[model samples]
Target: MSSLKPIRKAVFPVAGLGTRFLPATKAIPKELLPIVDRPLIQYAVDEAREAGIEQMIFVTGRGKTAIVEHFDVAYELESTMAARGKEMSALGPTRATPGDIITVRQQVPMGLGHAIWCARAIVGDEPFAIFLPDELLIARNGGAGCMKQMVEAYGEVGGNIISVLEVPRDEVSNYGVIDPGERNGALTEVRGLVEKPPVEKAPSNRILSGRYILQPEVMRTLERQGKGAGGEIQLTDAMATMIGNQPFHALEFDGRRFDCGSKLGFVEATLTLALERADMGADVRAMAERLLNA
Candidate 1:
């Protein structure tokens, strides 16, 4: 675990065109979509902050200006809230201090690897984290957030760490499943990675759950990477190259993850999160019961 740098920076790849949401995402970046009251990006950013991330690098594209503005202070809104005596605590988590948030344009919808590579200049030469805003992870029973858990594991392992979740065998092909070598509690020694392998071919049910603590060298691998499974440069392929070279491990997150990129998943996340909030839980439960009966 020598020469391991503290993970201080996190990259959020928010460039994808959210065709899954259609008309709602027509004018808005899907990252700005609200899960309950907070936007999807907020949850991801909050988790990064919890993991001690000092800088946030957002890899964005066209139609992503809303995301930039969302993190900036709204002077007019603040003034209005102050005058109206409205509680300002809710806005605290969404705003980032100046010089802490940075943005880079991907300019093309290449792939996840390409989007992450676009932030290489700003990230420089240190271990950093990647948070997929679409993957909303709710820490089980007030436990540590997903990235926090990965950061703790990275501190001990001192190499690449990716959060993994045990998906059903039949659904393994939908994710980047890991081939396990050894398991010590939540940490699994990653032997290999299969990007969306068939059910019969899947080495394990554990799949990448959109949270990662990665070494900077992976960015260099992505630079020369060619198209993979989706005819676009895949991050999984670049990460797979680092398995033998580094102490790569898969962290099985102790939480529930919602794939907010899809409609069904988005609705599930909204309802689940809403039900978890003390202020709205009762009302949401009542509404859900009514809808179920209707």
Candidate 2:
């Protein structure tokens, strides 16, 4: 088999107003909202890096300066650490070199398709990965790092790869369902993709999670794609058109995904991550027990 093209660039769609978060998000972008110490967006970037992505491109909107700043170097902080001679142990592996990440603007709030299209100039001509920060996944050995696993699979198969999971038939209305044409272990060939089909009308139980590895041609389709559901450009519609042209598949991940976009998912991610932390686990567990008793 011919070796698959390596995916080095990653696109993050970070333009939403985060109205769901209201007051808090009024000042802070939801992507910058903290899950433990790291922001939601950082987890996505870290996941992409783990999957061997070299360039990071963010499609951000208004009032998102903080998101850009977060990835930028903290010179004052690093200087203080250096002065204290704690740079080695303190800023060690966590410190990322400058220019490792870049940012671009999405002036319009058209849709996911538009957000991705905004990165076209930076993305150039390469197969790229897109990870939605709202879906926070936690794995054991993988540690919510589904994209890393998908990248490994892509190296072998060489096509568009989407991370998916089986949801209940009723829940299928909430996501894009994969039409599995063929299967290879966790990898399933995608014959078609339907976003939010009715419970009784779904082709399969497989739901498209927030992870995607798409070919460059996808942007062209998105450019021509008219408004879809919600009167906005939909990425699903663009992917549906590419099914017959090239290989498209879904990889069922070995991890738990938390929908941090919703309140419940955010709370769950917070509590779960806290429980996994060595320093906070014992105390959080005690607090949970107290709440249960009350």
Q: Highest lDDT: which candidate?
A: 1
Error of 1 at 268 (Å): 0.8
Q: What is the lDDT of candidate 2?
A: 0.86
Candidates in order, TM-scores: namely: 0.98, 0.94
Expressed as tens digits, the lDDT of each residue in 1-294 for candidate 1 is 656789999999999899989999999999999988899999999999999999999999999989989999999999999999999999998788999999999998899999999999988899899999999998989999999999888878889999998877999989899999989999999999989998999998989999998999999999999999879889999999999999999999998999998899999999988898999999999999999999
Model 1 local distance difference test score: 0.93
Assess the local accuracy of residue 290 in candidate 1 as a C-alpha lDDT between 0 and 100: 98
Off by over 4 Å in 2: 81-96, 142-144
lDDT per residue, candidate 2, 126-150, as tens digits? 8999999998866675354798998
Cα RMSD (angstroms) for every candidate in the order listed? 1.0, 1.9
Q: What is each predicted model's overall lDDT from 0 to 1?
A: 0.93, 0.86
